[model samples]
Target: MAHIRSRKHAAAPQPAHTALALAALTMPMTLLAQQAAPAAAGAEATLPEVKARAAAETPYKADAVASPKFTQPLVDTPQTITVIKKEILQQQAATSLTEALRNTPGITMQLGENGNTTTGDSIFMRGFDTTNSIFVDGIRDLGNISRDVFNIEQVEVVKGPSGSDNGRGASSGYVNLVSKTAAREAFGNASIALGDASRVRATVDLNRPLDIALPGSAVRLNVMAQDFGVPGRDEVKAKRWGFAPSLAIGLGTPTRTYLNYLYIDQKNRPDGGVSTFGLPAYNFGANTPGAAVDPKNYYGSRSDFDDVTLHMFTARIEHDFGRGTVLRNTTRLGHTEQDFVLTGVNAVTATAADPASWTVARSRQARHQTNEILTNQTNLNTEFATGGVSHSLSTGFELIHERQNQVNAQTLTNTTLPASLQQAVANLYRPNIDDAFLMPPFKGAYAKGSTLSAAVYAFDTLKLSDAWLLNAGLRWEKFHTETNGATFTAATATLPESLVQNAPLSLTDNLLSWKLGAVFKPTADGSVYVTVSNAYQPPGGANHALSTSATNQASPSLEPQEGSNLEVGTKWDLLGGRLAATAAVYRSENRNELVSDGATPASFSQVGRRRIDGVELALVGQLTPAFNLSAGLAYMDPKIVRGVPGATGNQGGAIVYSPKVTFSSWATYKLAFGMTLGGGVRYVDPVVRNSNLNNATSANLPGTESYTVADAMLAYEVTKNVNLQLNVYNLFDRQYVAAVNNGGSRYVPGQPRNVLLTANVAF
Candidate 1:
């Protein structure tokens, strides 16, 4: 672990007027105490009065306390925002980004290839994939790659359509990762962790004064490294190491600037696992555990891969002109490159009885991506008595550009013998197998695409006679995209003769998206809000045409997918804001729906429309002073209202992957002597694969079962600067699948029960 140390500078205490305003809002009880003071011998009581005044004037304060004024109030935001504080992450001994997010409601994670570096980890929110909308410190880091969680301050999940503030692509919601920043006081901490699967990790955070000889300049550094050993289930192994360093320069009076950089390198080797389509749907009946093969031999010898590198950088400047007027400018850049190779079992010979005789086909894929973003946000807000009405305004501008490049290749060996015979000979003479067989390389394909977006939005809140407050907002956006790609089959000897050809394709789209909303606050602690928002997505390379479409050509001249959502929600704070709860009902309609048939991978078309109606309830904050609780429940019914010819049933049921019921809850208790203990449980109902049209044979396909998982953690403070923690994940050791591929043979299972121990020291 690295060590961080920084000099301390104490700013002058706030002026008397500002202090009075804060006291009026936060400690009205102080005024009551003053009013209740007994009228007595004033001359003799003068000394006590003076002492009380002096106590209020004391400037000394705890260095680690969080100021209420600096923290944003949850009630002020219209959307549902959940925050996972740094203290919680440490107490939970969160070893990965996914684990940290699992504690949040309405979020689910799917591990890639036994949690290997080469596999792409995916997150889903509200039934929509979230790979393209992740953010770091309010900047978009949109790429199909894994993100490292180090030097993180907190994770905020903003629910519902956030286009008004976050620009486009936020149809479901957005995740914001706040990075650690230089503290104004001296502080440093280091921690080491060891866990199951031979996992070892070390992390350090340090804040140091840049100019101890001068004043007002500081630098902060954070670094993390982890090595995950091979899992007991297979021969897979993964390792990742990364660092984040930042520098802050305090310009003379009211201006500050900062620069930060991130570098991460990860590598892994994955043994061949079961394919989704190669296995039976039901694993509980008539199937012996590990019956297909010895659990030890499940990993084939030819499977291997690696993820090269990922890099990111960001810089920003903030200026305060005075009196609630501020301006902020920021820029961010990121790049990723990956190369991987895997041995796949030929589908033609993938039979249960002859599974051992299945031949292996080698393949490789390489991908590169880059993203750049620029934003200028200005807020001119003021509160004053104007005709007995007070108003507050917020507005901003944002621009973003993202691009991606991908190349893929595959090859097969023609041994001119039965797969069983080939496997036997290859095992006996491994070295001579390559020489005796004819290798035909599969021609590679490339894809290039880009997205450019710009938006300007504004929202205002007007206090109507104190009791009723009115809120309104509007956003306008322009989005454009272009993509071109080609596939070549020249590398294979049988391709040209068998009608295989190289073809090039291109696509482009430009459109506008907008949103509007209003809220009525009847009381300080309760409010009702309604919103109408429109979102759009331009068809890109990934959703482009393939050879299997009915016409043998891509859908001609695709249009932008558009949606409008109407929502009504209520928020309330109970027990002096210690307990918060929200309930919302929404109806969203989508046009130009992207629909695909299971008959062929490329059989995709745009349907007329679809609609989804749902309700959500969530609660957070403290149930009592000693017990903290968080929970969420959701119900959704999504269905297609229109259908095209040859398409399946449209209005019978909800869409695929949209489970009707989901619930999560967590509770923690504070104990004596700086110790805390907690536990949580999560449950999700089974989801159908093809909800619109279900066949009995396919109905038996594995739906995510309704299962419960439990986690617990214990933390003890050894000293002012030292603490220790122990965490147990999946306490019940339940075996369940997280996701299944189309073929039903490949199932991604949830992690087994695991334990981690951590020690931390701070100064």
Candidate 2:
């Protein structure tokens, strides 16, 4: 069938109420500014008293790690960035990367076809699924696979399209996992944890300066390993094991080098049985027996997968030329190879009555990826007097190259009904038990898909007089992509045919992206800013598909997706910078929008425009002298302006898997005798199923109901060098589906309540 696609153009204008709302949000900042004057004066008047208070409070040093050099205060950043620290992950006893992300607002997950082990990790951010943009440390770790969290120091989520800095990725956002690094001081820490799911984990981090006898350098290493046996209902079980090791060396005074490697292997059974027949819309019920089948005997088979191994090497050098000028260069290279085998019954065509006629399929896949990147950044970053005004300039150039190869082979077998189902059916026909059907090898490969991007960017932050801070930046990027591979169709009676083709396709494009903003900081702890930015993504190999036209049309040429965002926000600190809050309202419009049609399998056409408007509120800081809290609430309204002609009228609503509202909060309080207690709650709004459809004939699946989850943890200090912690996830034992397929054939249920105990020793 020929695909139908159309394009639309619309100019999104901000509403008056939106401006008013933004204005109101700034009142707190203004109020805080007005209050700071008197407090500073009072401190000066009572210098002795202030000094005495500072001395007394200095005894209780905070455990929070200082932000890295590249990181600025949250309020000072031009864009939204959420940082999840190592302490938070340890305190919560997070098992997987997904569990850790759940605490962050405006993020969601969609399950893969297989179970958690082999079923790749699919994540959504800001209403879009672009998991390929995920990064390890500072380099890209593209592909569809479960990411390991061991030896990770923190995770940073940079909201909004990061194409300028992250190359081609999700137009919505990107996630960066920062690996643990050696410390300058001598220190060592180790932890062991046991959880209710039969989960066991151990990690150790140590850093020691090189002996004085060694030549001008320091070396350190970190290592971690974990094994988990997950317990599930109905005879389902999942297991995983992994390890990571890293080494770092500092050369001279201004140069550093690091090397790291990771290896993970996992084997597990499917979480639940796949449905044999399609179910009705809005069926949130449990799995049950279908016609001609016994639910008791139907289950999925075990699968084994491994991330195999990954190697990364990096070098950084910094040079300071006096006179407030510095130049820094960073280079990185990474390589990864993965292999796995997945086994499962074809749910699309299976029944208990004809159990003997059931068909089982097994697939083996391998992937190899490599990346080389270099960045040179120079900063004058100094204030200078010009025309009685202060000016600051920063510039940088980055070049990146990434290439990957993916291969897969599948085999299927069909057999007659088993003795257990002989009475249920009179006649059953099965495919021949030939060698071809037993383990027929159907192989396909995607080879030499590579991307190269080069960017030169500069920005200036000018103190235009004392009342206003004006910032503007522009980035010019050139991107090229090439892919050479073959496409294969699914098997029918036997192994489907592979269309052998190797037509190398390449595309080059140059685009300019820019950001402009103005911030007015009336006082040290208050500021209001308004910004406008433009971002774009070049078409890539993923968009390639087969065409029936003669001469084998190969991959079609598509226009790039472009977006513009407008935002206004205000930030404030109350109670002497101890409590902070921020509120923002933004609207984004996209051109040459990409939309998925459920009818066409795996075909994505760039057509129809869309827009999204949302409001976000965040608060982080101490609620009282002995208590701390962090919370976020977000509301989004997204709509489609145009869809396939004659299909749906301005089909606009919540994007698939994108909830309308989300809320998350956490609080921690100090207890007696060097102890602390903490807990958090999270809520996701109901999703509107089939909300993108235009006609009544299309299935209008009801949206999933909203759900709330709670988690708590308790910790006590055993000694200066030892500590113990206990954490409980899903405190209420809430049972709900985490994700559902469009046809409702495969559903992923949320994990059950789990408890973990951990002990840590530091020296």
Best by lDDT, which number?
2
Off by over 4 Å in 1: 1-72, 110-118, 212-215, 230-232, 251-253, 270-303, 343-389, 411-442, 491-511, 541-556, 596-605, 643-653
Worst 10 residues of 1 by lDDT: 12-21
| Tens-digit lDDT track of model 1 for 1-763 | 1111111111211100011112223233323322332321122234332211111211111111111111124454455556665666776776556666765656655433221212554665665555555767666665545566676777777665555555555356667677776644667899998888788889889888776643356777788888775433454566788877776655333444556677778776643334333234443223222223222223233335556576666665444333343344455566677665543322222334443443323222323334434333333333344787765555666676666665555333334334643432221101121223323243455566565667666666666654555566566766555556666644356555232333444454444555555566678777777767666554552223322233322333566556667888888776665677788888766677556544544365676566667788877767666777777787877676764324354444445555677787677787999897888887877655544454224422444566788888887889988888888878998766565543333344566788888889897
Worst 10 residues of 2 by lDDT: 9-18
Candidate 2 lands at a TM-score of 0.77
The clash numbers for all candidates, in the given order, read: 12, 7
Backbone clash pairs in model 2 (N, Cα, C under 3 Å; residues 3+ apart or in different chains), count: 7
The list of candidate 2 runs beyond 4 A from truth reads 1-72, 113-118, 213-217, 231-298, 322-324, 343-385, 411-442, 487-499, 541-556, 594-606, 645-650, 688-691, 694-703
Per-residue C-alpha lDDT of model 2 across residues 1-763, encoded as one tens digit per residue: 1111111111111000011212233344334433543443343344332111211221111112121212224554456556665667777877567877875688877644332223556787777665777876545676555666766777777666655554455656678777665444678888899886567788777767666653234444555566665533343443555555444343332223333444455544344333323233433233233332222222333332343455555443333232233344445555555555433333333444454554423222333333333332222233355897665655677777777666655333233223343221211123221112122244644455676778787776677755677777778878777777776654568777556676677777887887787888877667788878776755662322222222222333666677667888887766666666778888766667555553444345677566668888877767677787778898878666654433453355546667879998777788889899999999998654354364223332244567898989899998989999998878998855566554334455556687889998998
Scored by CA lDDT, what does every candidate get? Answer: 0.55, 0.55
Provide the TM-score for each candidate, comma-separated.
0.77, 0.77
